[model samples]
Target: MDFKLTEEQQMLQETAARLVRDAYGFEQREAFCQRETGFSAEFWQQLAELGLTSVPFAEQYGGFAGGGVETLLIMTELGRGLCLEPYLPSVIHAGGLIEQLGSEAQKEALLPRVAAGELQLAVALEEAQSHYQLHDVLTRAEAVEGGWRLNGRKSVVIAGHSAGLILVSARTDGQQHDESGISLFLIDPKSDGVRSRSFPTMDGRKACELYLEDAFVSGAALLGEVGQALPALRYQQGRAVAAQCAEAVGSMEAACTFTLDYLKTRQQFGQVIGKFQALQHRMVDMRIELDQATSMAMLAACVADQPDSVERSRALAAAKFIIVRAARFIADQGIQLHGGIGLTWEYMLSHHAKHLLMVARQFGDDDHHLQAFSALLDVA
Candidate 1:
């Protein structure tokens, strides 16, 4: 497979990199994170105006319809900048779901709004004790007079509180852990019977625990067919995993770059730390791992757009597993090499390190993806 990016892809990468450099300086990033919403509306608008919000959508929705590689290109830059915006949750995950499953009318109504940055969306899928199982849904959606009444709770709904619209996963038939009955619904977050408790995450992002008590939605809210949401969920989730791997690669790159710069400048025993053979070896090791992780990310992006579902899942799981391990190693080495300053609140490395650790657990962690990869292989 070809590894080189196309001309358009290169332009997208350069645009994203320039935008982050100009707008997401370390101090700017920190300020955004400290906000009550944990991100800046203005920054999100800037991204929208820059055509970022439209990257992965179809042209009819005013988007460029760029695929997984484009997503990787954009997210890597976002990760490097420590961007606090909800682009991942709002645009990639939720938008992908809409694109994949929404009816033509649903797409017309929502996709354009999303592209224009007028709407932000989050998916409420994970429930308490579900771990990383996408099919382990306890939320229930029952038919009502005019629509459906949803009841149950969701945990770690990323960007849930800030999203105007939420894509919720619920069981419409079978029991929890059964993929057959799982379904997806679009709900108004501000509607009655919807309660959200928000909190900051370790990585300076926000998430919410959502409680749905008889939350009512019109028939239009159901995405795809009833009891057939699993396939779309898995597809979007695979895209998310690919994006995460790319983001983690970018984070690892930043960590290594900044740590290397610090080593060059930081002196001990009348010599720069970088010149020390032992330290040099460690930095080389970090770089080696970064390269390997990057290769895996590229592979994941390539496979992410595959037509075959099982092939895509296995490839994504492998990439995620590699990325999780490499990101943790790079973050740990970055902090240790930088000494106590690495742990300080004001330092960029601290944020990147923390974000890297968080990325390991996002979507699915190292162990989770490892098992998934192995299971796929067994089935193959």
Candidate 2:
């Protein structure tokens, strides 16, 4: 398998890395976190100018026609900088869904605005009872006189408060746990009978719990088929999991690099900690974990690019399992090896660690992915 990236891909990766290094410093990130939106409009505009917001879409939709590898590169760079932008929710998830499943009219109205940073979207899929089950939707979308009426609650909606639009998942046909009958709807966040309560997440990001009480939407709001959206939704989930693994790899890389640099400079027992054989071994282990996790992330991206669902599921689950374990290990060791300063809010490692831990639970946690991987193998 060829792991080499194209020149265009390399340039995209470099550009994203440079942008984050220059614009997402600790102070800038802190300021963004303090804001209610949890992101900077200026930074988002900068990303749009760089053509990043359009990476995952087709050229017809004003995008670069990029794929999983492109998404992986962008997300890894964003993770390295601890960027709090809603790129994952807006671009990779909701925007990608629209590009894949939206009608011609819907794409014409939405994708361009999303690429221009004029519209941000968040996905409301998770319910309180649905831990890591993608199809466990309790939210209901019933056929009404004009279109559809939504009545249910969605929890932990990423970037929900700031999103101008939301893509909500609801059961339109079958049972709660059934894969069929799940449908997605494009919703106006400020629509009547819709309420959202926003809060800060562990990684200093914003999320919301949405309560929809007989909220109404036109028939045009329905995406894809009414009761056969599971496949498209699963495709989106695969891409999201791959992107997340890439981000975790980036976070682990940063943590390990910071710890290694500190060990080389910080004096302990009148000598640099790097000189201590014991500390050197620990750093080597951290470096190994980082490399392994990076490989797994690449594998995930490649597998996600495959046209086969079984291949995608098995590979993504395996990649995420490795990423979740390595992220926790790398983050914990980074703080422990750095001594007390690593825990201080002033140190970026502390924040990176927090962010990495948060990523573990974003799409699914270690146990979830582990179980998924095992199940896939069993079926195989």
| lDDT of model number 1 | 0.91
The ten-residue window of minimal lDDT in model 1 covers 302-311
Best model number under lDDT: 1
TM-score attained by model 1:
0.98
The residue-by-residue lDDT of candidate 2 on 291-320, one tens digit each, is 989999999887766775666799999998
Q: Residues 279-318, candidate 1: write the lDDT tens digits.
A: 9999999999999999999988888777756778898998
TM-scores of the candidates are 0.98, 0.98
Give the poorly placed runs of model 1, Cα more than 4 Å off: none
Which residue pairs collide in model 1, if any?
none
